[model samples]
Target chain A: MPPPAKIRIDLNSAVPAYRQIVDAVRVLLVEGALPPGSELPSVRRLAMDLGVHFNTVGEAYRELAAEGWLDLRHGRGATVIARGSPAARPEQLQEFRTRLRSLVAQMRSEGVAPARIAAELRSLTESLKP
Target chain B: MNSALFLSLLVVAFTGAFMLLVPHFSSPRYLFAVTVPAGFRASEPGRAAIRRYHWWVVRAIAASAVIVATMAQSWPDLAVVLAMLPAIAGVASFLRERSKLQGYAAPPPGVREADLAPDGDHLPRWIALALVPLALPLAAAAYLRAHWSEIPERFPVHWGAAGEPNRWAGKTPAAVYGPLLSGAGMMLFLLLLGLAIFYGSRRAPQRTAILKILVACVYFLGFIFTGVGLMPVVRVPIAAFLVATFLFAAAVIAWGYKIVTDPAQPVEATLDQYWYLGSIYCNPQDPAIFVQKRIGFGYTINFGNRMSWLLLGSFLAGMLGLVRVAR
Candidate 1:
């Protein structure tokens, strides 16, 4: 039997709950942790788990479905769907670089060394490999 | 001894017994469930505090039993009031124990963590079909129907301290069928409410425990209500029914406490800061209308939720109906 799909969210995080849901699920999808045909818990169930509003989870599911990573149908809950790789667009790449730079700067401000940051970045890249 | 005095003694004994179980329920094993880090259950302060709590409650219950059997008969009403002393003392002991456990500086990692709730269809398929309880009341009604011809025209509605019938009612359909219908209605209402609580609650052993207790209590109600329903026909002593009901209630409560505090079953009960007045659980962020009680071994309504207000309204309505029936 396939392993259960899992996602973790921090309620205390600065990020909004719905955004956290999207980020967490998208990572799982990209990592193939959630394969096509995987059934995500219903909005009510996930909302209950996360201790968030039902609409928050519903919005996240809708956003994922819009991104081609999930298929949401009435009464079926959400199902992961197959998505072909699409190279990062120019705007998306720019956005990633901006976020990466901001994160690195924040890490450096927190007294992290440049060498540690580079190594951490390399480790994250390595982890993405199948 | 008068029946009222005997009944009061029984109430005191049952209360004492229930108080004894509270310490175990409030123990770290059930409170934190498996959510706390390994070995925290064995922590010196927590274990010591729990042991202290158990010792206090046990002693209180023992003393209470002695007092009820001997001293209570002298002034049963006063004894009934005095009964609250041990129960109150037990609660104070538990609160102190709770304080000692909370004195641990480090919070459990799982305290902040959340469990993935089972699919919204978390209730067992069979629970949704829990129409079994309805049959108890119906069986009672059926029995009454069978003896319809010979049923008494006047029966005791209320019994006084001397065991003599004080209030009498003629065997109209209302008097005959009222208790049965109302009992059946009450049973059905409780079952539906239980279903609501079962599904509205998140993942935790207490969730199942609450449902089981609810089911068990309903069956007990079936006995009480059916007995009361046949009051006109069954000339059995009112004291007998009251005694039996109280005994059954005590047993059910004890059984429920055991289920609630089972060490083998780890729970994912979340302790929130929103527990208003230290008893009512209130969490605005939680979509669940019900959550496991932090101070006790059962579910409490989240006053923060809008649905909780509706539940309170319905509960009040039910209580009013019960009051009318009692009258």
Candidate 2:
């Protein structure tokens, strides 16, 4: 596993605030900076840390949650859920299955073959498991 | 009921409908057409500045809703009500920001326009795409309607203040509507979710049918039972079901519009590629890059769509129940 990513906010960059947040979180997840089961800073705290509003952080968290990266509870704040984690119940599994199918379709359209895609997916799944 | 009651009901229903609709109608382009656009061509720096300002406005509006919700003496429904303004602002900001990013550089020398356009006869395909998700919800609705007698009857009612400070506040009697109306609302919600899924599947078409079916089944389970098995735990599933449905619906609408209006570019093309020098979707990417660019974030229209339906369902059920009780 990698170290947690250093969260950076580029005030001068042209990227939108939400995208910046998304990018930063993505970097952390990709880099293993935020390990599976790591608790993320509260949206309020992160917003204050980044000098952005709570909604910016919330939106970022919401996006992440939608993508299966973060687990969002009403007041518990966001927590990193490793990709392909086993935390999903039946319904959540269905959601993941749906997302995976979409990703597969997308990758296929990109000409990724089944064998190569399957291998890469297996590796990804291994990385996500506890 | 008296004319006054009828009028109040009509106003409330319309208010709910308008609240549900504001996002769809006052979308970014529509709002920008009313406000900015012409101002964008002045300078690149000016455009960037406008984009930043748009984000700030979105934040401010969302914050205002949070404040109002804090002060309001309504039910938990106020949060859903408050959420509408910011959600709309967020969408508007997305469009405005995309517009600001127009025309930094020209396209590559020999990029064929034909490669950009996916194919002809896309309308029927698109409509089919939209309808795919509808099947699950319709099935769920039909099942619930047929088994309406199996639905449990218990108010599980509580009278208290509900909102930011209190869970239930300023409450009247548990305004009961009949099981039939509640069932009907579930069906309506399923219908909306189907529409949303159909729209969403256009952008991401993996297991579109199965996902809809799964979502519908989960929701159907929540709607049919009388909170019997879970007791206090029931609300959690119910809330999740509603939230998921709403987010799913919104995703469908947003993505569906993208599919119908624009030439079907491959997924990887950024908004900058498709645009006509900074109009709505000018940016372009090839099919390969587009398909490969899944960073795990696509809009889920489930949250708002479900809430709107839940409230509508709850209200209808309550009204019908009130009539039955009165009769």
Candidate 3:
């Protein structure tokens, strides 16, 4: 059997741990590595494994539940759910465009050519496809 | 030679050998409890440190052996103190080596990884086997009750190395059943401790391995204490119990050695700064109550965690209660 899906977080990173957890799980979910109906470790177990406070994993799980990607029950652990793809709101689309432009600008400032940036974006998008 | 003197020297020899082998019992990534790069243990400085440590330990053991042999007959009680010389020297040498390797210490790994799959929450089915030893004490109690008249009015409760009685207890329920009760309490404690380690510690094969060892220990305690309780009715040699204890300890150490030397065993990533004296782990931020020890094969309590303090308090209270009942 293949190895179980794993998530990695850098404790020394400036980014908050909860945000890192949320983003890593979101990428795995998008890539279908974590399929619908898959169970997540209990908050305490994950927190201990990650060497973080319990509240950090709980916050990340709650965020995913709010995004409709997970179902959180009282005693049962978090579970991935089949979420309906809602039509992107005009404001949400605009926000994504703005964030994308800002990221591209930062990469360009670091001496990345437009062609390289576009190729990197294409590679990531291809990986996201189910 | 006096048997007591011989036993004391034997203990000193065993302790020295165990201490000399301590460095090899940890993961290769660690040297003297400091995290180092892979293959660093074979490096020149590492080789020098190990050589120096062995030199000090060997000298200490020789000295301890001489002291124990000389003092064992005249000061039998003091021989026990002399037997600790090698272990004390080992610790002092270990700390010295650890400080020397601080310059070469690898930066602690910042990234932590975990499987998203839910696992290790449930206790193993074999854990129920720990309960099997509980029956030994009960059976001993029933046997004792059935032949209450056969028990002497006063019988030896404590014995010397020569299999002679040193202490006696009267014929009372407390005296007759105390050892059996204490044995049951110990088994129960081991069971609860195994459960705690399973649920509170990070999931790893080492955790399960340690739990199995604890189960073995419970069985050992069960049989030994039951035999002691039946001493008034049975004439089993005291040397038999001593030999059994030594054999059981050696088996446990061998099993631990196997786990330690296994390259595939994953070591817990912990900051060296959080470890006090290279043994006492106190990481306040880490949610784990028990983390794998860098110096040994099993887990140690994270003294910084509040839950650990609570557990320690409960253990002490339980021990005090056990002592009171055994008395």
Q: Name the top TM-score candidate.
A: 3
A67-115 per-residue lDDT for model 3 (tens digits): 9999999989999999887899999999999999999999999999999
Interface RMSD of each: 3.4, 19.5, 0.6
**How big an interface RMSD has model 3?**
0.6
lDDT per model vs. reference: 0.70, 0.45, 0.90
lDDT string for model 3 (B1-327, tens) is 887787778778888988999888898889999998888899999999999999999999999998988988777767867888999999999999999999999988889898898977888888788888899999999999999999999998986543457889999999999999988998898888888888889888999999999999999999999998888788788878888998998899999989988899887789999987889999899999998888867888999999999998998899889989999
Relative to the true structure, candidate 1 has a C-alpha RMSD (angstroms) of: 4.4
Residue lDDT tens for model 1, B1-327: 665457656666777766766645553533222223445657775577667876877787666656755755565556566656568777788667655554453443232233322354557665653567677768877888899988877778776544667788887777787777778767777787787787777655667667777777677778788788777777676777777877777676666667655657555445535544346667777788887665456777888889889988988898788667655
State which docking tier applies to candidate 3: high
Q: Where does candidate 2 stray beyond 4 Å?
A: A1-130, B1-58, B73-83, B104-177, B184-204, B207-327
Model 1 regions more than 4 Å off = A72-77, A98-130, B1-7, B27-82, B92-122, B160-164, B237-247, B262-266, B269-272
Ten residues in a row with the worst lDDT in model 3 chain B? B158-167
Candidate 3 residue-wise lDDT at B256: 94
Q: Scoring each candidate complex against the real one, what DockQ results?
A: 0.37, 0.01, 0.89
Give candidate 3's chain B TM-score: 0.97
By DockQ, highest first, what's the ranking?
3, 1, 2
Best by DockQ: 3
Clash pairs, candidate 1, are none
* TM-score of every candidate relative to the true structure: 0.80, 0.28, 0.95
